[model samples]
Target: MTSSIVFDPLLPWPLLAVLAVIAALGVLLALWRGLPGWLLRALAAVVLVGALAQPSFQTEDRAPLSDIVLMLVDQSASQTLADRATDTEDAAQALAARIVARPNTELRRVDIGDGEDNTGTLAMAALNAALAEEPRARVAGIFMVSDGRVHDMLQAPDLPAPLHLLHTGRQGDWDRRLIVKSAPAFAILGEPVTLILRVEDDGAAPGDTLSEMRISIDGDTPQSFDVPIGEDIEIPVTLPHGGLNVIQFTLPEAAGELTDRNNTALVQINGVRDRLRVLLVSGEPHAGGRTWRNLLKSDSSVDLVHFTILRPPEKQDGVPVTELSLIAFPTRELFLEKIEDFDLIIFDRYKRRGILPAIYLDNVRNYVEQGGAVLIAAGPDFASADSIYRSPLSAILPAEPTARVIEEAFRPKVTDLGHRHPVTADLLGQETWGRWMRQIEVDPLEGEVVMTGVDDKPLLILDRVGEGRVAMMASDHAWLWSRGFEGGGPQLELLRRLAHWMMKEPELEEEALWAEPTGQTMRIIRRTLGDSVGQVTVTRPDGTEDQVQLEEVAPGRFEAVYEGPEIGLYRLAEGDQSAVVGLGPASPKEFEETIATGDALQPLIDSKRGGVVALQDGLPSIREVRDGRPAAGRGWLGITPRDAFETLDVTKTPLLPAWLVLLLASAMIVGAWLREGRS
Candidate 1:
């Protein structure tokens, strides 16, 4: 309770000043004229004026509020290194106990961990949130226990009080980090691609010598080499296959280092072929021959080898064989010598014309079984006895001709299976494709029928033999669609997808298992031609396996999303198909710099007249200081007292009552009159 005199004047202050002036004039007249009663009259006037000015005593009951001290504890990934976690916990508990024991003080404990969206340690954000929840006037000081590796120092809020840091980590803490300075997302297969990297030491490094680094491809045995410390080195890597290549680079752990998480780096580079080589064998010259040539030649990435048999050996013309314009077909070179060089082999209206010997046909069959691709476009000859399906290559063909040729116009339609097969799934303009005039009838002995012709007959069949793939197209009048026979279809795109699928492009595989990583989450997808697929077994970098069920979103397509608990390599396998992918980064931002220092936040601390002390030394003693003064010193941290209070009740009592002042003035007036009369 506190009391003070307060005025409640009956008249305006200007009016009271005029009354006071009259009283002073009276006193001056009495002094000048030697009148003894003048002093008494002046005293009465002063008492009258005082009665008009009311004075009251005001009392208030207030409760003092405790000063708030914000203590932010860093529990981020970096703080987990070495003994920093233990030190941070110990410092936080000790500080909390000290603040609680201090009179008129409150501790606002805030535990801050890893930040969202891969932003390292957002200690400032956590601190701001805690401050917003408390009364700003009562905030005394701000304290943090961390390694000083905050990534969001620029977002630090304006301090209402002193800010200090109780730093974690040790003096001689060192760390060796592998930094991939530059890496390409794509590289041509069979060619060397360069990856620029750097190896450097931080803190109190042991030596300035070369370090031995090991590199491996697709989990192969790692090869070790020496790399100069603190220098960027260029590593040239050649991909073995035309697909995604996983390369791992690691540096052997040095003694007295912070962690080994930053020692290994995983790089995923897509390998692509330089060009696609295609072998197109046309049994005879036809209108569709140019169409095949046009499609293959239009793509700059394709190298086409075309052969057209203008005449057979049985056909004798007036001109001799040497005089004819047709050149000898290179059957030996193309079919036997360099068969593996071709990525795809297309047979357009090919028949048993005796031009290719039986042994050559057998070699073509062997080619398909040895990881080759073949596409057969059949015509009327396919239904005849001389059909190529009747040759030695028939064993590898997907279908057998029934010796019946359908000669009616019918639109090609995708079967139910086609909607699921990657080769024909979601084909452009598939529902509005033009009609073909002729389609050779055939029976599918093995493989998937993707498209149907007239009477629901198989128009397209796709199959796999040994390590190769085969696709059979039963119509020769597909060229009509190219000429806009009924509104041109997506022929170009359809043929392009077919060629790529046949060539075993990883993206076009019917049965594929792959993962798409976005941040720390990976969406695992499995595509198959079958109606159903089994659960995918995921093996994390720690060699722990988990079976995740996939929900079918479309026909024969199953998918599931997984949030990775840690950063590193993850392997996904479904049946015999498997894929390896990397989530997040090889070296996370938290582990980039593990040594604890307050250099990042020193400026902010200094601006608020605060200081930083290492927990390794000892817990600092808490003290109180004035605002704008140094709030921290050797072995001590200080807080400022706000001296704030909340008023509960107030009372006002009149210091001098009006009646008593009036009575006193009247008595003095009467006494002055009697004195004047006597004088």
Candidate 2:
């Protein structure tokens, strides 16, 4: 109910000014002529001008809207730590009740959660979003209940009213965290790779030191060593094998520390082969020999040593014994002296000859037993007496020659077991690859037959002996398949899988189980010939076991997915088989440091001129103070109220009406003249 005066004009200001000047001049003329009626004439003219302007009263109807108080609550991972969650819940409920109790005031609660990855809290972003939803005029103030760790401080909105913070942490809260400053993805086996690690103390008292750090590989006994505070230290770690290696680093817990969860860290490094040394022995010089050489030499990682036997001992093409063109083969140095230097030995159509004595063959067998790979490509001579199976190498060979060879054109087909084996599975679709001609027949002994030729005879046999593997391709005509004689086969993929399988690649194992983490879920895969696996027993971080049944999705591939409830290392086992895989980072954002403290949110509090108030200090009462006044007190924080008002009634008075002013002015001048003449 406010009131104010308003004005209303009937004519333009210029016309009104001209009329005033003319009237003033007329009055002056009458006065100078000694007319007594001049004064009365002036009074009449003013009255007429006032009656011409039309005016009216104006009023506005307004009902006051409720004042808005925004309450931003930090519900992120950091807020869930220790007693902070309970503190925040209590503070939020109390603040909401107080704001609602005030006359004509409303409370808007905004919950802030964890950001993607380890990006920290997004407090300011939440604040900006809440501000946009409220009416600017009715907004009284903003209040935030959070730990001091806000990541988006620069994004805080330009608040129309004062902003207050009710922090939810204690002053003496502290934490110790293990930080992996640097780590590489790949490392050479048996070589020491330096990883930079640091143990940091946050919100700790000055002069407190971290005494010891323990490092371990795959849950083994930890090696304890001294580590200085606040400095990066290099720890040299040697990978023991060629595969995935998990390393765990931990720091000793100090007195008055916030939480021990963040005191440890886990890292995974993929181990690579030191070197792929290959020894290719060719029995005779042929076009297929060049194909094997070209394939092995093309790879930069492969160390290839090619040795070809161009002439046998029984050859009589030499002119003389001393003047022969062929040189004596050094079978002793190659097969016996340096055989251990090679990781794999490939024989392309090689046969037993007097060149390589029985003693050398025995050394080759020992080489295969001591973690070495061997691949034999048998030819027509495999059915003859000169076959390598007749030599000392027969002990390591997976197949024996039947002395009856089938020389015919046929397309090789993968067996049912091979379809599930990583080597031949998905070779070229099931029925879609080019065909091969000229497959030499052989009989496989106690090995798995992956491929069969004409008459359903084994063409490719694979077996394991000792710690090593042996693969026998009973056909030297595989090059014809590469040349697309009949059509063409998956010659390249077949050859690659064969070579890698012989090298004992983990992925190609027939009976294998592995799991990989994908966010909160894990993909558990098992490759086996069994129709179905028994219930897979899963051991969680909390030492709870859950049996999950696996379903056969493909011919031999079995899989069962499990979603981990928390982040940590998960162990999966079925019968005698077992595997270990990490689900997430050692210290997840939620459990990084469970204790609530103001260290993380300090920057935000300092920038906004706000301070932390622990719930243990008693839940403070909320109040609305005037703008620019102090917003916090001994037991509570205050939200400032804005001074705002609105206009209600307005009345405008008319200056003059045009017609009345004209008639009165005409009469005034005539009457003035009459009075003067009478005088």
lDDT of 1 at 431: 62
lDDT by residue (227-317, candidate 1, tens digit) is 9999989999998777778888999888889998899898999999889999999988999989899999999999999998877777876
61 Cα displacement, candidate 1 (Å): 8.6
Q: What is the TM-score of each candidate against the true structure?
A: 0.78, 0.83
The root-mean-square deviation over C-alpha atoms between each candidate and the true structure, in angstroms, is 7.6, 6.3
- The sequence of per-residue lDDT tens digits that candidate 2 reaches over residues 299-332 is 7778998888876767757567688666667777
Compared with the true structure, all predictions reach lDDT values of 0.89, 0.76
The prediction achieving the highest TM-score against the true structure is: 2
Model 1, TM vs. native: 0.78
Off by over 4 Å in 1: 1-65, 279-300, 303-341, 350-369, 384-395, 427-434, 479-490, 531-535, 550-553, 644-679
